[model samples]
Target: MTTLEPAAVADLVRNTLAAHKSLFLATAGSTGPWVGGVYFAESGEFTLNLVLEDRGRTLAAIRENPVVSVVVSTGSPMQPFLQAQALAEILGRDEDARARELLVTKVPEAAPFLAAPVTAVRLSIRKWRATDIANGVLPGAELPSPRLP
Candidate 1:
């Protein structure tokens, strides 16, 4: 089996996430785990910023449990992958305008939702597991988690 250093993978993940516009977010609701595709704007520290419906299941889940998982694949599934479990902070309406501006800048289709009542959620990446899919191994197989402050 091939092995990768956590720090190297972590840097690669940061760069890759910065290049991608969307990610797959996984959250748990009362029923069970649910996944959604969301377009996001990243913070300089790699935190993910996105606007979510205030009454949506993801908001409910975040309110109930602030830990969420995310997966971002570069270019294609066969490329490098970055997976992490992050801390979710549900932002108040006061932050909506800035969040909406950031999101709409990347995904223009989200402008309509910004007109509606929505809450912005920021996912602060804690640790990541990475893999290179070209080698046919699980992206985040058994590498040490690269934690962020």
Candidate 2:
């Protein structure tokens, strides 16, 4: 099995968060079911911003069970493609002001949404893993192989 170095994984995670402005957040619903929602994410040292409608199901689920998982795909349908999935054990309660600031940075178009009544959930990523399928796993480095004869 191919595995990336910690540093490499961290870099990849950072870049993926930066590249993809939005992420799919998955949480357990009140009825013991799984639910997913799209939200604009703002990456941080160990946490990410999940901005959503204040009275939406996503917010309700988070309120019930703070734990959540987020998927940041490469937006490629190809199999074994590079992707970063993070499992975050959310901490504390929603912070509207901070969430608005981060939302503005990540999604300027979301300014209106941020201005409106919304909930900002902070996700503290406890464990996360990233894989580079196209390029072989390396330690803190990404290099494309040159064509050979």
Candidate 3:
């Protein structure tokens, strides 16, 4: 697999984030495992922010375990797809305010949930992979590693 430089990876990740509203999150719940789709936002460093129901299964699982995997993809034929293994945790009071602001900008659809009792998760991405990131390549065939520093 080819590897991308930090700047290029950040650019591609940002583009992927901007291009998709939904992301598939995989988590290990106390009962078992789960995968759910959630709307997301990205921090300047590209950390993923998710607003979820406090009592939802995904959140419950997150409380049990912070580790998670997420996939953010672009449907445009010309765009690349990005995925990451991340560690998720509820936001602190200090972080919540800013994260909420950022989240609202990307998904105004989340405004209602922000005011309610909800779980705000920040996924600190550990590893990232991309497809169709190469100049002349087919989508999904190449696993390009984004060695994020």
Best by TM-score: 3
Candidate 1 or 3, higher lDDT? 1
Which of 1 and 3 is the better model by TM-score? Answer: 3
Ranking by lDDT, best first? 1, 3, 2
Off by over 4 Å in 2: 32-34, 77-95, 137-149
Clashes of 2: 0
What tens digits encode model 2's per-residue C-alpha lDDT throughout 15-123?
A: 7677776666777767665656455665563567766666777777777877776666655533122222334333344465666677787778778776666666666
Per residue, candidate 1 scores C-alpha lDDT tens digits across 96-136 of: 66777888887788778787877888888876677776765
Q: With candidate 2 superimposed using the best TM-score fit, by how many Å does residue 39's alpha carbon deviate from the native?
A: 3.3
Candidate 3 TM-score to native: 0.79
> What are the per-residue Cα lDDT tens digits for candidate 3 across 1-149?
45556666667666667788788899997789999988888875448887888778989998999889887764454567777778887998878787788889989998988888887788888766666645543333323334344
Provide TM-scores for the models.
Answer: 0.78, 0.73, 0.79
- The lDDT per prediction is 0.75, 0.59, 0.75
